[model samples]
Target: MTAHSRNTPQFYLTAPSPCPYLKGQFERKVFTHLVGDDAAQLNDLLTHGGFRRSQTIAYRPACETCRACVSVRVRVDAFEWTKAFRRNRALNADLVGLDRDATPNSEQYSLFRAYLDSRHSDGGMADMTVLDYATMVEDSHVRTRLVEYRRRGPDTAVNGRGAGPLYAVALVDHLSDGLSLVYSFYEPEHRDRGLGTHVILDHVQRARALGLPYLYLGYWVEGSAKMDYKRRFRPQEHLGPAGWELKDG
Candidate 1:
């Protein structure tokens, strides 16, 4: 069935839970299961409507009193790299990212674990096991890719794949209008390289190369220091009551 077929999507609200991004706040979500033949199309519509996907689920914040979680996307055609962003890209010039089908790897899990331990020890996904990682990457029905970033090695000229340990990895979805960054993590020790920022920059380039208009960056929680980096990608659009509008940083 197509996304507009008679089978209508059913959305549900989650019970109150402690807000992950902001303290002293409770968070709720309106979510639906993305499945069947129309999963990809449904995903596209939901995403454009301000929902985000996790595995086979699409969800968006539906808090009772707070609207802190604002959906953000980078406007690819209008994106211009600032001096700081250019420096971030230059800092990781030795690394290359290889796009692979959404599949789980032990090495990716190892780096994921290290990243969780080092950066988000008390966060929601800190205790995720290898199986969970596998499901996160492989359980999707929509177009998804796991891009692994690594340092250039001896065989770099022969094959495009980078050699040595993994420096960073991003779980991304290819949507009709843009690429959606589902989740990403990098080697904690390499924080100086600003790999997180580089990953977004790379995706912006990828979207531009693909002729996509936007690169979805998921929710940007206002006042959350952890989400401050997202605002750096200027010429972005924030989905609000009036719909997506340009927010020039």
Candidate 2:
């Protein structure tokens, strides 16, 4: 056995559990801790290698006999907005996104609670408390930013931050090569507006403007309706054994 150095991350596998994306299937994850001075740089490389960060740990699916979880990243500069995407963008013309330090507050928690109740009531994170929400935002040992979406209101000229109530929020990580969308949620009542897709489109444009090459959108599980939307982002790359391959379809 090779001796491990302090800089080497130790990997662990989660105990088999019921798969969240697939019915009647078990799932496991291979993960390692993200900490210390090199955590940010290590996270960037691991993320490109198909790992995803959840708080202080970086993980990816490692289930036996399953290849359903595919990592996806948009080609920022080449992404073309579809007619529907354009419409969604127009629909949200009055909305503005404000990036701030990852500090949890009551307002964000209220919106987060409503989002969980309406969109993911039966999911694992549905029962998360305000403290849990805070940990999700503030527990990171990496470069993270909280992007809050709100509608423009009176006195918009005074403060650059959007006014009115919060409609969506995304926890994003800044990597060396691109931006990683860790998690995002929106006002479930406005689901018809396609706020989720719109946020992604906006992020893609932001990444391109910043000279970044990709926008990570987490895992795309095959056969999961909740994850089907990810495939709509054309000119995306999917990570596989052979490496990241462009998916035209």
TM for every model, in the order presented, reads: 0.96, 0.96
- In model 1, the runs with Cα more than 4 Å from the true position are 1-6
Tell me the TM-score of model 1. Answer: 0.96
- TM for candidate 2 is 0.96
Give the number of the best model, judged by lDDT: 1
* Cα lDDT of model 1 by residue, 1-249, tens digit: 636544468889999999998889999999998998899999999999999999999999999989999999999988988999889888999999998998898999999999999999999998899999999999998999989999998888788889989999999999999999999999999879998999999999999999999999999999999998889887999999999988866
